[model samples]
Target chain A: MLDLHNLRLAENGVPHLDSITASFAPGTLTTILGRTGAGKTSLLRAIAGLAIPDAGEIRLDGADWRRLPPWKRPIAMVTQQFINYPHLPVLDNVAFPLVRRGEKWPAARDAARAMLDKVGLAAMVDRRPSQLSGGQQQRVAIARALVKKAPVLLLDEPFVNLDYKLREGLREELVEMLRTETGTTVLYASTEPREALQLGDRIMLMAEGRLLDAGDPRAIFERPATLEAAQVVNAPPINIVPLEIDTVARMGPFGTQELGALGRDLAPGRYRLGLRAGDIAPGGPHRARVILTEVSGSETVTHLDLAGLPLVMHEKSVVAHAPGSEIGISARLDRGFVFAANGALISQGASHG
Target chain B: MYRQKYLFLLPGLIALTAIILFPLIFTIRVSFSGWDVYNPGLSWAGVKNYVRLFEDTRYWSALSRLSLLAISTVLIQYVLGFALALMVWKDVHARRFFRVLFLVPMMTTPVIMSVIWRTIFHESLGPLNPLLDAIVLGGQPWLSSPGWAFAAVMIVEIWQWTPFMFLLLLAGLLSLPSEPYLAAKIDGAGPVRTFFSVTFPGLAAISVGALLIRLIEASKILDTVYVLTSGGPGEATETASYYIYIRGLRDFQIGYSAALSITYLVIMIVALTIIAKLMVRFLVKGQS
Candidate 1:
């Protein structure tokens, strides 16, 4: 296990990581998901011993890793932008790390060939990095990172430059490789939450350099520790609207509607409700007008004008509602979350966390 | 249609004849004949001037000394320039300020620099000798002795040209991709191995550019030699260009000087070509 105890990093007096403390289990994939400048890259660099935290300690397998140099550590990194030695053939680029570790040149070359074949890049052995496509070059970098047989691997947005269609394929390949290569801990980081959802054994959410929440992908999706964490992992973003809970709850444009059965028992106060498009549905007694509707593949998404405020609902394949048409909106309040005015989580799925 | 296409080239062709071809033809013709500024008549001397050029002892010695100056100055300039560039390539406190300071020497006009250095190298009146004497090593004649005069000229050349190499090398070092460096750091490669494998290969093309410019310019060196020593104390610092100037202007042997100049030109072109070819041989395979 790799433990980062209270990692705090600041740049030019501006704080980047505000006491990030998390432990990544061995042989498991821990992916940190965050938008740009959220300190995902810095965390990965700290793990690889490239960026030293101002106040923290890194221990690997119960040993203090702060004293070991980056090269002396048992890890290899694949940068976000794929980089290879332009002056060496693909074969040599892969063989380089092994040679640096005191292996004989011929033996290193043989091992590198085997590693490249594993990544399905054996035919590109004689080609230089410049001669290959972006995806292919990343394959070479991956091969080089793997040939060292290090127990730890750090991948920082390894497929961001590839085609969008190709990115999912490469991500799956990498996740599969990490799975098959047991006993190797992989710290993968990306801004795309769907990538984390698909590949992370443990999903780490970060915002403004703080670790917001970390748990199994499904569990975090269901009970994110904060409203902000829920917004980060949603595809079309979660709908967060303010609620004025008076004697009767005031929700959306639907004038002073009674609180739904799930929220009826809550104290009358101000709060924010966060829910995905799937949380609300059609064919219910709560009345609203359709603002706009979209049918994609097997699902239909209808934006509803609930009173004067907007709410969106996802329906099955055949449902259709024209614009400005009145329709009943139902709330699946069991799947929604409530937060305080300061954005702290007050409840999960209609109950206190 | 073909005539119209060829007609478009007529103006440039006429200008080339007047500027380059005319002077080149006159020089080639004059090199084969006996002619002087004092004589109005041109006598066909065939290979007589060429034979005399081969037998001239001063011509051979001057070429040897120029070769020595070119080799030593270029070596020192590249070595020192590379060291300085590497020093400032990383996170220095005032990185741009140091780069601009290093470029000050290259920014100055070479002729003016040579005149300034001449004063500093003056045997008796210069501050350099007094400073050396104060350091417990007594002063010696710098420009008055033959060997010291050559050394003084070489010093001025190396000082001015080292900055030229520095700027080119620094630009090259900065242009290197950051990914390979990060990869190397994680690959367990030390600083020395990273330099040899990652840094030097990336710098090979720029190194060739720096070397060629310095080598070709140093071969025709005259400004520093004129200001510092002027080929004094028994002809120790005379290069081929300086010798040709004396032969044509002072001795009035324009034919022999022109012949010798053409021969030296051919030798220089051949030497530079060989060096460039060798530097680029295996590098072209992956130097990208």
Candidate 2:
């Protein structure tokens, strides 16, 4: 188990992470989901002992990791950019760490070869790093980290540079491999929701260097705690629209609807309504004009202008909606969430007629 | 496309052919003829000059000594410069200062360095002798003695050229991709293993190229030896270039000097070719 208590990190006199306290369970994958510059990499670096937090205590299996140096922390970190020695052969690069520990050449070679074979790179043992492709290089890095066999493994967007097929395959392979191979505490950071959903046993949603929510993958996806969390978990991002509470009753379309008292404490003014693209039904009380449609094979993402507000909808089948076509839309309230104008979650238990 | 590119490079081609190729052909032609300063005429001498060059023990000794100097200078410069480059590459304290300091010797004029060294190495009044006398049992002649003079000349050549090696090596180190070093570090490689397995192999190309350049430069070592030894102490430090200068200027043997110059040019070209071929092979293997 890796635990961070009241972790506050600052850079250049500006706060990066403000009092983040979290624990990663052993034998489980904990993924940090955030946008670019959301302090995800910084958090991973802090855990890896590459970056030290100003005021925080990092504990590994109840032992103080904050006091230990990086080499002594029993952790291995793989950065986004593939770091492989170009001059050395693939086998030697993977075996490098053991040599420093005074292992003989033959033993180091055997250990490196075993790890490379685990990563399906045995055939390329004699080849240099530059001779390999980008994906191959990433795999080599993974193999090197695995060879170290550190208790804590920190990966920073490991599959970001890979193609879709390679990314999915590696993700599944890595998830299964980590589950079966060892009980190392893995903390993987990524901006992709699919990756987070596929690999994360527990997902932490973050935005602007602050943790928005943390829970099981299902709960985070199905019932997000904040607007940021909802947006992060949704495939095409949750569609957010501003509505006047009093106007919902006065407007002819939604006609005197209570909305299950979702945004009750909104002072009878503005509130934000969030609904996943899958929850937005085609026929409903709300009407909008289709602004754009993007067809990506089996799914079609349609952008609508509803009441002069831009909204996005993801449809299972291809919907050839023209730019000026009028569309009727409604929300599945069970899958919808309401928030105050200040971006706080109001309620997610609203019922629909 | 080829014609257009050739037209663009027409002026350079014409100048090279006229100034370089034409003179080289004329020199080769003159080398085989029995021409002298008095006659100013050419008669086919066949291999007479070549035979004389082989029989002359002084010439053979001079050639052998120059070869020794070239090899020693190249070896010392390569070792010292490579070591310095590795030290700087490892992020030593005051790396910038050391880098700049290593380059100072290379930047100084060889003639001036030789003059300074000449005074320092003087047998009686020089500072070096007194320092040696105070430290050791006896003070030996540095430039006046045949053996010491040769050693002194080689040292000056090394001092002048080691900086060139350092600059090339440093550039190579700086341009290397950081991925390999990080990979080695992550693999738990100690400082020495990392250098041999990663750093040295990465630096192979630059090292070979630098050594080849140094070899060529060492072979032509003249200014320093001229300033310091003046090819004295029984021609102890007389390089091929200095020999040509002595024959042409001092002895007034224009034909003989020109003939010897041709032979030296041919030998240098052959030596450079072999070195270049080896360097190319090393570079290719390193990349692979």
Candidate 3:
């Protein structure tokens, strides 16, 4: 097990990691889901002993990792950028760690060859890193990291640099490869919600250099503990609109009667309404103006403005909503979340079932 | 119609021909003629000077001695310079100060520095012998002895040029990407292993370039030998350049000296080209 306690680091008075405490159990892959500058890389770097925390305790398998130098730590990390020894061939790049740890040439090469074959790059073993394409180079880096068979592995958005198609392909390949290393504790950091949900056994939500929540991927997606956590784990970005619980909940453009079963029984107070992009559907009683529309893969994400409140609506397949065009929209408030004005979750809407 | 484009290159072309080609072509012509203090004018000697050069033992010995001096001094400078560069490359107190201080010797005029060094190696009167005596080593003849005079020339050469190697190697170090070092550290590589596997291999191309430049410079060693030893102690420290100067200017045998200079230039070019090829083959292509 890898454990961190009150990890705090500040660079030039800008906090990179603010009081982070987390742990990774063996055989579990935890996806640290956060947008850019959310300290995801910093957290992984601290675990790999590359970055030192100002005040923290890192213990791995009951040993103090703080006392160990990076070379002494039993860890391996694959960064977002494909980093391989340019001087070495693909085979030697993979075998480098083994050789450094006193493994003989033939044995190390054999292990490297096997790992390369697993990552689907056995044919390019003799080629240098520069000779390969971007995706292939990252595979070499991944193979090198995996060949060590280290107990703890840290992957900081390793496939994020590749094109979308390539990213998905490599992510699946990594999952298949990681499955065989059952005992290795893995920490994969990413910004995409789908990737975090697809790969991680658990998800860690981070914002502003602080980890908001960590739990089962599905549970975190369904019931994020805070508004920031929900925004981090959603793709089109969750819409946080102000809510007034008077006789009934008044939120955005949705009047009390149009709220369906959502605003029926809510405590009377001012609160924030957290609505996932999918919670807002087209062709409803209330009208919203389309601010912008984007089509990605099979889904269309549209930005909407409803009576001065900004909103995002996610639609199923290829739907064209022109900018400045008015469309009828409605909120599935039963599937949304009610939060305090301070952004703390007060109550999550019950599941449709 | 596009002939005007050629005019753009005219200035640089003219400068190249005037600065380099003119002197080179004139030397080749001079080497074939009998031009001396007595002759005073260029007169075709029918390869007589070239034939005489083949039997000149002093010139051959000087050539051999120069080769030895250049290779040994350059090799020593590379090692010492690389060490000094690594010391101040990162994580040292007053690193900026030390970097400039290391380069102090290279920036000084070579002839002037050699003059100062001559006094430093002046057996009884020099501070070096006294410092040696204080360290419990007895003082010996520094300039009067043949072997010591050759060594003195080498010492001065190494001191004057090591900074050049340091500058090139340090720039190479600074330009290397930081990611590889981080990867090496995470891979459990110790200091020695990291150096061999990462740092050394990364610097291979620059190392080849620096070595070739230093080798080319070290071959033409004249100033130190002229100031410190003056080819004394039975020509022990007489490099090819110094010997050529003796024949050309001191002895006033311009034609013979021109032939010697031409032969020396040809030999250096051939030798350095072969060395560069070998280095690239081993240090660069081998790794790749």
* Best prediction by DockQ: 3
For this target, which candidate reaches the highest TM-score against the unseen true structure?
A: 3
DockQ values per model = 0.52, 0.39, 0.71
Q: Could you give candidate 1's per-residue lDDT for residues A161-225 as a string of tens digits? A: 88877787888788777777788888888888778888888999998899989989878877777
**What C-alpha lDDT does candidate 1 achieve relative to the native structure?**
0.84
lDDT by residue (B240-287, candidate 2, tens digit) is 889878877787666676678888888889978987887777664744
lDDT values for all models:
0.84, 0.79, 0.90
Candidate 3 chain A weakest lDDT stretch, 10 residues: A255-264
Q: Rank the candidates by lDDT, best first.
A: 3, 1, 2
> Which scores better on DockQ, 1 or 2?
1
Return the TM-score for candidate 1, rounded to 2 decimals. Answer: 0.88
* lDDT per residue as tens, model 1, B135-244: 99888788888888888888898899999999999999999988788888899977888888888888888888889889999999987777777777679899988998
Error of 3 at A246 (Å): 2.8
* Tens-digit lDDT track of model 3 for B24-87: 9999999999999999678988799999999999999999999999999999999998899899
Model 1 per-residue lDDT at B214: 92
Q: What value of lDDT does candidate 3 attain over all alpha carbons?
A: 0.90
Q: What ranges in model 2 sit over 4 Å off?
A: A59-73, A114-118, A243-256, A261-271, A281-297, A320-328, A340-346, A350-353, B1-22, B36-40, B75-109, B116-142, B145-155, B190-197, B252-288
Stretches of model 1 off by over 4 angstroms after superposition: A67-69, A243-250, A254-261, A264-268, A281-331, A339-353, B37-41, B282-288
lDDT of 2 by residue, A1-353 (tens): 78889998999887777788998888778899988888899898787666789998899888987876555567766788988877668888777776666787799899989888888999999998889998899998898888877778888998888887888788787776787646888899999887788788899987777888898987777677778788887778888755566645232333355665554554676666787787776888788899999997688999888777677888899888888999888866544577766777777754321
Ranking 1 against 3 by TM-score, winner = 3
